[model samples]
Structure formats: structure tokens, C-alpha cells
Target: MSLVRVLVLEPSELDPVGPLGDWLRDAGAELEIVAPAEGPLPPLGDYDAVVCLGGEMSASDDAVHPWFADVRKLLAEAVSARKPVLGICLGAQLLALATGGQVRAGTRGPEVGPLLVAKRDVAAQDPLFADLPFTPDVMQFHSDEIHVLPPSAELLASSPRYPNQAFRVGACAYALQFHIETTPHVVARWCENSPESAAAARPGDVDDGRLRSVHEDIAETWKPFAERFVRLAARYAGSLPGDPPPPRSLPLV
Candidate 1:
């Protein structure tokens, strides 16, 4: 299959696509990066997929950053059209709000640094998360969380601190309350600049060697998942609803 053209939205300067962009390229997907910190979203329907990256802002902070309102509209449109959508961290919280879900400050303090989330039972039936480890290593830097999922949203993963960690709404849209795109440099900058991240780190947790090892583990697991996502977008984009499979020809003598 050919590469899927993806629209990547960055809500803030502090959050870049990082390893997510690299894996998208490796998966034969092209990205159109845009920053909507101050303005509205670009004209939609020009891309095969939508990837909303994380930021430090809360989803309900449209009073401060008006662009968040526009992002919610775009996410709703993607969900309505059944376009494959991936939301990370703040992006995930936005997805929850874009639908009927709710987002609020984490009750268990900041879930920063390396963490593990156990896959939920429904994850065994999900296309993207079916093969993921029971407990996957993911980078966490969010202080807010999804408190209530929208109607019909399937909870896909959870941690001791955050119950609404990963979920899927509709058929093709996914919302993840963790960070899978951070590289070592990204983690370092986050730890240095974000007070929540720095305070959440325990001794030796932010060491270069320890962080790099976790990044490697994340890449090993998530890169394939990203490739699979691109493939799903390609297949789902053209598949007609309730269409029957084409008959195959039998080998001739």
C-alpha cells in the first residue's frame, strides 16, 4: 500500500512530533505539520489520517488558547467521518471532550516519567492494541486525565493511578492518555522545563541510560503499532460499508 498522508497538529511549541514523525515516515506515511496555537484549524479532509500531539495546556483552556475550540471541532469531524485518528496526552483529553467524555485534573497527582499500563480485557479485541504487552512501558507527562469516556467508548488500558488511560471511540478513532512519542532528548527537555515532570521523577529515573532504555522499549512496541495504524487508515478510507468481499479465482489446470 502507498503511504497515507496525515495531518499532524501541534498545539504548542514545547511539544513536537519527535519519534512519532520518524515512525510515521518509516511506516510510509507523510505528515503535514501545523501549529494552531493562536488561530483556527486548516481546511479539513485533505489528509488520510489525523494525529493530534500533546501539549502542556489543558483541554478546557480555550479561554486562554482559543485554538483548542477549533481542534475539538476537527476531532469531532474526523470521528464522525470514521477517519483514523490518534490523540496523545492533551490530545487524548481533547478527544474525550470532543466527544461526550470529560477531562479534569488528575486525582492522583502528576503521572510523570516512565510508567506501565495494563491492557484492559477489551484490548484483546482491538486491532491496534491486541498484540501489545499486558503491561506496556509508556512515557507519562500529563497532569490531567480523562474522567469519563464518551458513550460507547471502550476502555483499552489502565494503570493504578489512571483508570482512563487508553480508549477507543467509534470504530477507528483512539484516545491515549500516555506519551508514546517522546525521545530521550524530548524527555530531557520535559524534565528540565516542566515542574510536574521534574517533581515526579524519582532518583535515577531521569538518568540518560535509564530513559534511553525505556525509549528503546517504547520504539520496539509502538513503531509496529503505528505502521498498523497507517495500514488501517488506508484500508478503511476506501472500504464501503457492508460491502462483500470479492470472489477469488481458482487456479487453472
Candidate 2:
């Protein structure tokens, strides 16, 4: 088969990324990148996987970005097509809304920095997370969180502040509250852009260098998990409802 076509619904103009791009290139996936507010999503054509990256905007911010309205439809199509869909942060919130789940404010506090994901049985042993990094730290920087886990959704991991840190929908689909693609370079930029939010999230102040170091470590720890995710997605490539075959290998490049 040819390269798996992947559609990336970017939340902001910072849509094109090097690390993610490298992975896609190595995975032999033809990537389509687009900003959220650009326009309606072209039908999920020839797409084997769909990825919705993190953004400063909220899933509920439909009034500001008209394109957000079409996100639900696209998400539905991905499921309808049985293509793997992965949502990150804001995208995760949107995924919740798409699957009849609800997302509300994080009552505890904003989760930021290199945090530990508390393992749950459903994720710790599932194909999506099997033999991968367990109890490993992942980079987190978000204000709102998902409260109600979606129907047919399995809770994957949690943090001290947010319970539903990660989840899997319909076996193949995934929604991640934390960031695994946080590169060494993006940390400074994220911290700079999210100064107030970061300050509000952490009781004690964190310096830029320390935050960058933490991000590097978190990104490293989550590598095997991401590899596992990639492998799980491939197994469902020829998937149809009520017919799930054995897992395939998606080894890291």
C-alpha cells in the first residue's frame, strides 16, 4: 500500500511541526496540515488517520472560529470511516463533545509541567499501551479538563489534578489531555505564550530552563507510548465494526 494519508487539524498557525513531521515522514504518511479557522474540512478523503493538535482556543469557542463547527462532522466521519483519530488537549475536549460526552472546567487547578500519569488497568494492559512506558511523566499545559468519560471510552491515565488525562474511544480512537509531542524548542515558546496561565497553574514559580528540561524528559519518556499508539492504529487500518484482528507492529523508526 502507499503512504497512509493523514489529516492534521491544527488549532493555530503554528501548525507545521518538525518532530511530528519527521514521524509522519518516517511512518510513510502523507500529511495534510490546516489551520482550524481556515475553512470547512474537506471530506475525510483517503485519510487513514486524523490528528487534532493542541491550540490556545477552546472546543466551545465556536463563535470565534467558524471552522470549529465542522470539527464534529469530521470527527464523526473518522469514526464512520473507521479511521484512527487522535485528539490532543483542545482536540480532546472536542472529541468528548463529538462522542456524547461533556467537558467542563478543571475544578481543582490548572495542570502544567512534567507530571506523572496515574495508570489505570484498562490502559496499562491494553494494546495501545502494552509494554510501553508506565507511570512515565508527560508534558501537561491546559486549563480546562474533561469530566465525563465518553460512552465506550476507556480511561487510560490520570494526573494529580486531572483524572481523565488520557482515554481511548471505540478501541482505536484516542484523546490525550497531555502533550507527548512537546519538543525541546516548543517549551520556551509555550511558556512564553502561556505565562499567565502557567503562573496560575503552578503555586510555585518554574523557570524557563527547568521547564525545558522537564519537557525534554517528558517527551522522551512518552516515546514508547507513542510508538505503541502508532502500532495500535495500524492494526485497525482494515478494521470494520465487529471485526478486530490481532495487533500489528508499529515499531519506532
Candidate 3:
């Protein structure tokens, strides 16, 4: 079996690989995390698959966060290469923008809690979302949304508030507006820091323990998704046995 190599891009301090990392490791895939905010991105040609995590920054804020432009370029390259790519939240917006889709401040306002997204009819044929429940539980904490998906993108899942929830571009690339990687602690930290959560707070203010309880559902639904992604990476890796191995450690420029 070929060794699956995955490049994970972390654009901020708060966004870390939680459960998804564990699932990847369990599937025997190696993960290298790159923090482009610190320095330059490594060559996009290195990995079999790429997973770009969510961040607080808007995808189009290149002036404020200059790395976004580079990130979008890399995403476009990955799509052109037909490499399997998964983008969560901000990363998803980046994928959309890189491929000619539009993104702007979310019209539905900030979505900062556990919720369900109804899988679209197209999801029935998707490798990642096909087996998912009709209304899969996912975590969301973003103020920006994909306003229009690329013409080549396939709509996979959605909610009433956000119609462009999940989509696929090219054959192996996917973009998810909601998060499937967050754990309860991750969600808790997000809630504590998010002004949106503060504004939505009631007197009791734990959101009915919905944040804590939904993690089990998240694990149940997304673990398989993550594993399948690693398998996709492994399959890609097989085609390049003699290619140079992935970087031993993340580039920390």
C-alpha cells in the first residue's frame, strides 16, 4: 500500500486539526501542517491530498491577510491537478473564489453553533456525502459565505439559511461551508471567543448543551468521511511511488 501524504494548511492560531487528524492517522496517512501566515507556502506539488482548515479571516481579504491570494492560487492548482482537496469554512470560501465563485459577508449573519444541513439530491452520488444521513449534524462558525459557487461546482448539501453549504469542484475536490473537524472543546473555545455567540446568548446561555451533545453526531457522521479522504490520498499516492517524499516536518517559515 502506498503511504498517503496530506498537507494541512492552518491559517490561524485557533484552527487546529481535532478529530479529523485522529481519523487520518488511524487510516495510516501522514499529515504535514503548514502555517502560511508565518511564511511562504511549500510547493503545491508535494502532497497527494490537501485539507485547508477554517479561520476567522475572510477569504477575499487579501490586503489584510495577504496569504489568502497564495492560498487561493494553491487551491486552484490542486483542482487543476485533480488532487483530492477538502476545504472547511474559510477554506471553502477560498476554493470557491479560486475557481470563479463569489464570496461575501454571510447574508444570514454569523452561524456559530451546531446545526443540521440537508444533503442535496446530488449528494446521493458523491463519494464523501453519499452515505451521510439526510440531515447531517455539522458545526458552523463563520460570518462569510460562498455567495455563488463556481459553474463547475456540484452542490452537495445545504440549509435554509445557507444554500451553498457543501460543493465539489473537479472530480476529487470538495468545499464545505460547515465544519466537520471541530470537537466539543474546539466548539467551546469558539463560543467563548465569538461575539456572535455572545449576542445569541440567553441568560442561561449554554445553548441547551447543544454544542456538547452534537459532537457525538459529528463523530458518527464525519469519521468515515475523513477516512475515505485519506484513502483517496493513498490512491493518489500510488501513482507517484518514485516521486519525492513529503516534507519530513511542516514548513514553519
Candidate 4:
């Protein structure tokens, strides 16, 4: 099989691809990590899949972060072309905003620390989420949230505080408001950099031991999910240009 080529966009220096990079590589993908601020973005056609990582910037702050405009355009183009895409945290908010949804400073305040988000009934039939536990562990650190999903999106998971924890915009595009790619050390650095967000969590929630345990739980649940994503990308990579796209309603498995 041809290697699946994936473009991993890093919108913030603080939020690199992290463990997700290892997961994609181990799953047989060739990845290119790009920071839009450093240079012009490559065309979406160059890769079979795209993964947009989280950032500190608000998704709609195009004026403050000019590179956001190009990033949103790439995400929109990737979805339109039916390329497999994964958007995490701010990436998720950007996906929502780029596709006719809304994003804003979360009314409930920052959602930080390790947490569990319940999978919706719809997720039971989702290609990537179906096999996950009823509630899966995830790391949260964003101050903004996706208030509305894209018109075509299917809600996949939710939390009591944030109902838009996860959603699928199309057959292969997924967005997650939580983080599955962070490690304990990464969380520590994030806490240090954004003490306000860290302070939002309960006193012990962001502690080293708790962060480590939660990351273990997250790895068990989401590593397979990441692998499944690579398989989806590989399927797309193997198709001839003129071939019919995968059925929109069927699970890739």
C-alpha cells in the first residue's frame, strides 16, 4: 500500500503535534508538520489527510492572527475535497467557524484538566468513535469553545458543561474539543504558560500524578482511534483519482 501522506498543521508553538505524530507515523503515515505563521501553507491536494492541532488563539481572531485565514481556508478546502481531517481544540473551533458554525469565548469559562466526555448515541455508529467506551478520558485546556457545529455535522460526544465535545462534519472529517495528543509533561508546560487556565481546574486536577494517570487512560482509548484515522487516510491514498469516493454513510472499517 502507498504510504498515507498527512499534513499536520501546528498553529501554536506550545501545541505541537506531540504523541499524535508518533501515532500517525506508527500507523504507516508520512507526515509533514507546518506552522502557517512561518511560511505559506502548501495546497491541500498534497496530502491524503490533514490534522489541525490546538492553539491559544481564538478561531475567529483572524485580525489578530492573520495566518488563521489561510488555515481556515485549507481546512475548508480539505473538507470540500473529502480528504480525511482531524481537528483538535482550537482546531475544532476553527473547523466549526470555517464551515458556517460559531465559536466564542466559552460562556462557562475555560475547561481545563483531565476529564471524561460521554459519547452520544450517534457515536455508536460512527466509524472512529463507535468502539470507544461510553465515556472516554481526554485532556482539556481551551478557553474558547465551539458553540455551533457545521450544518452537516453529527454530534459524537458531549460533556455536561460543553455539549460540543466532538462532532463529525462529513464522512471523514472529525473535530474534538478535547485533547488526546497531550502528555503529562506537555500538560505541565501548558499549565505553566497559561496559569489562568490551569487555575480554572479544581486544585488537584492538573497535578502531576493525576495528569499522568489520565494520560494513560487517554492513551488506551485514543491511540486506537488515531490508528483508525490513519487507516482511513490510507484508504483514501490508495484510491485512483477518478474512483468513486467512499460511501458517505458507511463506516470505513
Best by lDDT: 4
Per-residue CA lDDT of model 4 for 203-243, tens digit only, reads 89998999888888988999899998988877767643434
Q: Distance from true position, residue 245, model 4, in Å?
A: 2.4
RMSD of each: 7.4, 5.6, 5.4, 3.8
Tens digits of per-residue lDDT for model 1, 1-253: 6668899999877889988889888888889999987566777678878999899888888889888878888888787777789999998998889888998888888888888999999899898999899999998888888999988899999998889999998778899899898888888888888865578767777889999999999999899889888877777655323422332322110
Q: What lDDT does each candidate get?
A: 0.84, 0.70, 0.82, 0.87
Of the two candidates 3 and 4, the one with more favorable TM-score, higher being better, is: 4
| lDDT tens digits by residue: candidate 3, 78-163 | 88777789999989999898888999998867776777899989899887888889999988788888999987689999888889
Weakest ten-residue segment in model 1 by summed lDDT: 244-253
Give the runs in model 4 whose Cα sits over 4 Å from its true position. Answer: 239-253
Q: After superposition, how far is residue 70 of candidate 2 from its true place, in Å?
A: 0.8
Candidate 4 global lDDT = 0.87
Where model 2 places Cα greater than 4 Å from the true spot, the runs are 14-18, 201-206, 239-253
What is the TM-score of each predicted model, taking all chains together?
0.92, 0.85, 0.89, 0.94
lDDT preference between candidates 2 and 4, better one: 4
Worst 10 residues of 4 by lDDT: 244-253
Off by over 4 Å in 1: 239-253
lDDT for position 244 in model 2: 58
